[model samples]
Target: MGNLTNAVTIVTSASSGIGAATAKRLAASGARIVLAARNEDKLKGLVSDITEAGGTATHRVTDVTDPDDLKALVGLAEETYGPVDILVNNAGLMLFSKWEDTAVGDWDRMIDTNLRGYLHAIAAVLPSMLERKSGRILNMSSVAGIHVGDGAGVYGATKFFIRGITESLRQEVGVGSGIQVSMVSPGVIDTGWADKVSDAEGRKAANELNKGAIPPEDIADAVAYALDQPTSITVNDVVIHPTN
Candidate 1:
């Protein structure tokens, strides 16, 4: 295992849940952090906590769905710190709906945020990492991506896409350069995962699914583990779930 000292890490959707927890975990390791999310106020709050704890941190109001916004976020990180050593794509929206209900709008939101948003962050950072010849890209997937469950069809699809693409990306970028890629797959977590379930039945089911949910910090630890691995060893996929 390695350490995170002095690495410039950019975490998207950093306002809450896995994103927020991961930012704190990485920051505690002495990594300089850039927190990005749509809620500027919340981002600042987290930044304050990190700084007060003696970790270097900054915030940016970023919507991962916007490619330009992601570009600007990376730009800010570069402008603040020299070059980004780690990029964490943690922004995702979960609005579960049964296919029979055909909630087109919810479907679009999942695709745009969970899938396309991941792509946007990767696109924003891959070039700079390539140029630097060293970096880490950590994509957040979920247990739902590993196994499809009822009432979460499209959401599962997006996670699956993340799992596949992250592995493929690891192969492509981690060849000779010091660059590395990894995926963190977590099961039901208590914070804000089911808040957007619009369909009544789907919403109820989604809530129940989180009954044995683990804390978001658990997943954050998993992300830190991936980043802590020596560059000679690539921590590709990590799956963490409540055993219940």
Candidate 2:
């Protein structure tokens, strides 16, 4: 394993949950962090905390669904900390709904944020990384992508899309370029996401599913491990879940 000393990193959806945890973990490892999320107050607080802890950090209020916002976010990172060495695509939505309910709105939200958002971030960073021929892109995926669960069909589909893109990126860029593409798939992380589900029956199901939840820090550690590697070595994929 290699250490992350002064590695410029960008983490999306860093206001809470896995993104926040991952940002903290990487910052503690001596990485310069640029946090992106829609919550300005929370982003400011997180930046303050990281700075207070002797880590380099900054944030921009961003909506991942917006391509222009992603461009500005990457530009901010570049202006503040030089070239981005790592991009953590973690901004996402997981609204659960049964197919019978036909919650088209929730599905669209999931696709917009979870699917398009990831692509936007990747597009913003990949070009510079390709030019430098060195960088890391870690896509946050879900176990739902591999194994479909009840009431989470569209959410699972987005993750499946993530899996496909991550693999394609790895093969296309990693083989020739010095960039490393990785993915982390977590199951039932306790990110307070279950309580945020809007659908009544979906919320009930989410709550039931979250009973076996693991802390977000667990996934954070996994992400750190995946990234703290030399360029010659590629940590392709890590799947984490609660034993229970």
Candidate 3:
């Protein structure tokens, strides 16, 4: 295990849920955190809390779906702290819907946020990391990607896409670039995502499944464990779920 002392960490989707939890956890480890999300108020409050607790942190209002915003986020992090040492790609959408419902809009939202968002953040940070030849990228995924549940067709597919990219990125950069790529796939973590489902039946099913959901902090712990390792070791994928 290694400490996160002075690590410059950028956590996207950091206004709430897993992203927020991960930011706080990493900051506690002495990492300089840069929080990014579309919500300026939440990001400001989070940064305040971290600094008040004797940690270094800043906030950047960013929309992950926009590549320029992601690039600006990276730039902000570098100016505020230093070059990014860790990137936590946590911005995502999980819109549950049945295949027969033809929830095309939900599908597009998920693809843009879950898939494109991740890629955009990666592109924004990877060049700097590559130049340094040392950095970590942790992608947050879901169990639905591995074992799809009812009414999560498009949402699960997007996660599946994350899984694929995580692996591909790891293969492409992990061996030669000294860049660690990892994935944290959580099962039924209640981030209030169930209540956000737009489809009626899908929302019902999601709420029911969320009954067994774990807290976002659990996944944050997993993220810390994965990142707080010696550069020689890569945690790869951590699949965390409730023991029911």
Candidate 4:
């Protein structure tokens, strides 16, 4: 991995799960981390933990569904650590149910947080990155975006959009700008995301899948790999799954 000593990074949904793990991992690698999430207490706790471990980190309570909050997150990173060398759009929600039984509100929440939220973050940070002519944007997509399943129709749609947008941005940014856009698509993993699964059968199946799921830290490692690559090399997409 290339040196990340002076890189400044912003990681959204960073209070827990994969986002939190990624923040810690990057900080350990010597990046100054700005953690954003809706939960203030958890975010503060994470910052404390990272600092105690000799990693530099700070937190901001951010609701990714709001564009202003996304803008504030990027601005905060700049105020504290200068230009953000990397931005990880990891904030997302997963609500699963059969198409016929799904609630409209749940569908809307998934779309807003999982899809629109990523777009908002990108819009917030793109101009600055363009001006600097160097940056890395990492979007947290999922394997569900690649394979259609019975209960994950809307959720998968959002992730698929992420994949598409990341690729499009990668092309739009071009090689001369030194901006790398990448997406990490992870398989089933152990996380509180299952808390939103209202279907009994879906919950049961998800629990079974998570029994042998990859750790959140594994996905963090994938993020580190993408960010640690030489500035001239871009890892367009990485799909990580548990061996089991």
Ranking by lDDT: 2, 3, 1, 4
Minimum summed lDDT over a 10-residue window in model 1 is located at 189-198
Regions of candidate 2 where Cα sits further than 4 Å from its true position = none
Q: Which TM-score value belongs to model 3? A: 0.98
**Model 4 misses residue 24 by how many Å?**
0.6
96-151, model 1: which lDDT tens digit per residue?
77889999999999999998899999999999899988999999898989899998
| Model 1: residue 178 alpha-carbon error in angstroms | 2.1
Segments of candidate 4 deviating more than 4 angstroms: none
Q: Residue 29, candidate 3: how far off, in angstroms? A: 0.5
Which tens-of-lDDT digit does each residue in 103-133 have in candidate 4?
6787899988998889899899999999989
Model 4 weakest 10-residue run by lDDT: 201-210
Predicted model with the maximum lDDT: 2
Better-scoring candidate (TM-score), 1 or 2: 2
Q: For each candidate, what TM-score against the reference?
A: 0.97, 0.98, 0.98, 0.96
Query: Which is superior by lDDT, 2 or 3?
Result: 2
lDDT of 3: 0.92
Q: How accurate locally is residue 3 in candidate 2, as Cα lDDT from 0 to 100?
A: 57
* Colliding pairs, model 2: none
**Cα RMSDs, all models:** 1.2, 1.0, 1.0, 1.4
Each candidate's number of clashing pairs is 0, 0, 0, 0
